[model samples]
Target: MACLSLDLCVGVLLLIGLRCQSCAGSKVYSSPGASVALPCGTRVHGPCSKISWKYKEKFFFFRDLVESGKVIDMKMGRLRVGADCSLHISDVSFMDGGQYMCYDGATSANTTLQLLNNGADEVFAVVGESVTLLCSDSTSPGVGESLRWSWQKKELITANQGGDVTVSANGKKTEFKINPDSSLAIKAVTAAHSGYYECSLFNDSGLISIRRRILLHTLHETTDLPSAPQQDVNFTLTCSLTCAAACDEDINLTWSHSSGEQQQGGAVVKINNTLISQLLVPKSQASQTSTCVVLREGAEIANHKWPVQGGKEVMYSTCSVCYPRFLTS
Candidate 1:
């Protein structure tokens, strides 16, 4: 029993050592203009094992023995390696997108590379308005070849059809023109003009990409009606009211005199209990101009022009009668 227990312990220790060695190296695939890191360790019984990097079956770096330092590939001079075997690639390109591998003799790992176009895709335009679509690549000002922009509308039968759109970027300014493409300018935007728009680039390598659906809306202007009447005197001057939708409640009513004095009157009731409001004036004050304003939830929504006594239903006019002050004789 003692011998069996000792053998079990040894087997467990051996399995742990194997797992640790396997965890020492890792592989990652990334797009061009992106960064990648390598893993390293000093787990082996004989000093730290050297780390090596590769791309597309090419040797990118081999560790230095004397200096114990990292190295980069001459072809990809921009790549950087740290003491810990991590790798970094800045401002990646389509060409740089690919497979990568890391190896430490007995241990090796591999990853596939993928390149992405970091370009703008969608263009938004209002109905009946003109729009321009732009497509570009992740290139610095003076580094890579200029990007060519092209657009296609899904409605077109073929990419080579007439009126196809094309554009080229000078630095950051993209100039647009039409070709067999339909994405350039729709003479006048309409309901039929709303659809999917795709923008792609044409470079040395033929790659086509697209941006998904964008919505266009047509906006219209509307007018609101005048508010209900507030205060009035003798009902000489009348108030007017208007609203976008029909009003429900009885509009509050009041009266005011030409001298700017206000008085409470009977609540103005809607004729036929309809939204329209009307208030009768005392015959004596019929000639005095008065204002009619509507109130809803303590807020004014509409107001008719101040009604004139014996005058046309205009906004403002002169008042005829002035209320006399009572004097004790």
Candidate 2:
């Protein structure tokens, strides 16, 4: 009986040493909406007939306890047990941050998952409004991970030519301007700013700490819309537009007058930050419908028709003041 007890004690000590040497202090970091793998301890050998992944006592991932390579129940579809008995989680979230226990029938291995919260999908800002793209580091602040900011903008019109913007810790930009904060900010947004932007945080060693893709959209403002012009006095049909945040001046405005009226001086003017255009026509011709078009890079952003009747509704009158005088004579 004494010899049997000694053998049992030796077996327990060996198991403890194996677990410690294999994966006692495994730690990994994963960004939000990403995937991560937790390796089982080196002590785990032999065909993995059964595997389980657990948080605390709750089992979230289970493989064939009775058979090999068969999944019994997986609480989330994002979970998969690798052939090496590792736990691979897809689309990881902050809620997934915790200690994960991996059981390989005889013994278990544990790993710590740290989830970073720097993931932004889309951002919408009115033209001329300021916007900031967010990025954060989840690790403890004092852990001394030197972080730097890098921004890249994707061009929609061209597939080959691309631009990049980088902001250092001191708030200096390489090509474009950005806020000193870890977030990238655009003061005045324009249609040119509309594109896919990638923001990545990297350590001084050039390793990526966190990465996120942002789709930035800028809104255009079409205001002070024209109403139907009256048929009497000399009328001025006007269209006004607000300036884009990016201060893009590659914008054009034009007025299309009814064909019945001889064309007059129709001019576009910039008043302060607003683009205004006026079309002056004689009272007799003003009643006819006209069109106001605002275009940016050949794309019409604002199109309006005055006096809904449109140019097609114009009716030309053959008789004028001179004709009446002639008839009397």
lDDT of 2 by residue, 1-329 (tens): 13244335433443456544444746667778766666655466866556655553232322222124444546467766666666667778887777665655566666778875545454444444455665453443224343344334332121122323433322442233443344555554554555556544333333333445554433343322235554554555655554422225777666655564333435667755556677765556534666565566865444445552322232111112221010110
Tell me the TM-score of each prediction against the true structure: 0.25, 0.34
Off by over 4 Å in 2: 1-119, 137-144, 148-180, 204-213, 223-329
Best candidate per TM-score, number? 2
Error (Å) of candidate 2 at residue 286 is 18
Alpha carbon lDDT of each predicted model: 0.36, 0.49
User: Model 1: per-residue lDDT, tens digit, 12-64?
Assistant: 43335543344333333333434433333333322223555555433333222
Candidate number achieving the greatest lDDT relative to the actual structure: 2
lDDT of 1 at 119: 30
- Candidate 1, 324: how far from true, in Å? 74
